[model samples]
Target: MPDTYNITLEISRYDPESHLSWVQTYQVEAGGILRFVDVFRKINDEQDPTLAWASSCEHAQCGSCGIMVNGKPLLACELLVREAVDQFNTHTFRIKPITIAPVLRDLVVDLEKAYDRVHAAKPYLMKPAPAPPEGDEYRISPETLETYVEATQCINCFCCATACISSHHHFLGPNAMMSNIVRLMDPRETEKKERMDLLYGESGVYRCHTARACSFVCPKEIDISHFLALGKEGKF
Candidate 1:
């Protein structure tokens, strides 16, 4: 059975120059089975056609629909409105724009800078020369694969970045570090030492304060702290 209720969404809207902010409230008939993304779309179609947001895949895998729901970073496609009401025990879900970054419009945020930072990390595999003769695929044992599996789940949603206090002041955030860790832990990669050297540099993993905020807000449940710890201990 699905529970039906009225939800009040307080969304923050921004305009160019002087950091102008405004709030628009929407009354929605919602259920526990309906995601916030759907609710937002319904509200937009019915009440405010100018409401702006982002989404892709609508399955939490694309990581494009990240937003601040009741001051928490969440995937709009992943959370149901009624579940949110139950969790907070309130009919009104106050969604403010992300505080760490400048809001582009309604719910859409400017993640261009964050994406640039991610690219600067060069988070990718650098494989050695291919094997000769049979040229078989590189084999990774099951046990070894298990170790790096968690880090590989990142969808680059930047939710972790939104929650990270370190990134609030121009830090690189956790996603890149997580990416680095994945490659560092991969059995096929032979560039671990070189990658670690870059990661341990001033603007790299060393900037992390072990705040754990990144892991706390990650939709994928990636343990960013564990990877940071590994980097600190030179254990990767």
Candidate 2:
């Protein structure tokens, strides 16, 4: 038979209108296999309808449901109950919104705020000058594409931003930095010096102290610090 576990949750709550932030506790009974999302679902369904959080694709692929579980940034959908217990080393889980983000309600944060720097960096491909001289000239070697492929997997979850120590400053954080690197690695991008200037600018890659907290909390297991280090060396 599947096992059932009793868990205690201490969640942070904020009221936008009243400017109130507080912590509340709840006792829940859940299956041992259930994820943190499931626990939150139970809380919303039965315990408190007013509680709020964000969740989609409940498998870590969407990168939503990012929150601080016992002071660690993580995807609520991906972290199992047993794993959370072991990771936190406590029976009661203390949950809150990730750092460096404005809390929209309770667990849900202002995703737009997290995306601001990325928007400023121009994350998408710039249209080639002169329209690329027809389509055939735009292709890249398979080996070249392979180099930056991993960087493209960033889901824009903002977990890295939460884990970053320098986020208190104007630093752009991990996802935005990776976006800059991806464009740098792309063979067709022509403004190499311009992109590098942005990457190395104030609140840029130089601000990262290589704490690797961003890499450690990333649900995707991306080597974000490695990319920044390579960027510093101008290795591309």
lDDT of each: 0.79, 0.84
- Colliding residue pairs in candidate 2: none
- Candidate 1 lDDT at 218 equals 89
**How well does candidate 2 match the true structure in TM-score terms?**
0.92
Q: After best superposition, candidate 1 residue 70: deviation in angstroms?
A: 1.5
Candidate 2 yields a Cα-based lDDT of: 0.84
RMSD of each: 2.1, 2.1
Q: For this target, which candidate reaches the highest TM-score against the unseen true structure?
A: 2
Q: Alpha-carbon error at 76 in model 1, in Å?
A: 0.3
Q: What are the runs in model 2 whose C-alpha is more than 4 Å off?
A: 127-138
lDDT tens readout by residue for model 2, 44-162: 99999899999989877887799998878889998888887777776799999987678899898888877787886778766443435566567777898878888888888888888
lDDT of 2 at 68: 92
lDDT of 1 at 105: 80
Q: lDDT tens digits, residues 110-151, model 1?
A: 777557767776677776635545667776789988877888
Worst 10 residues of 2 by lDDT: 127-136
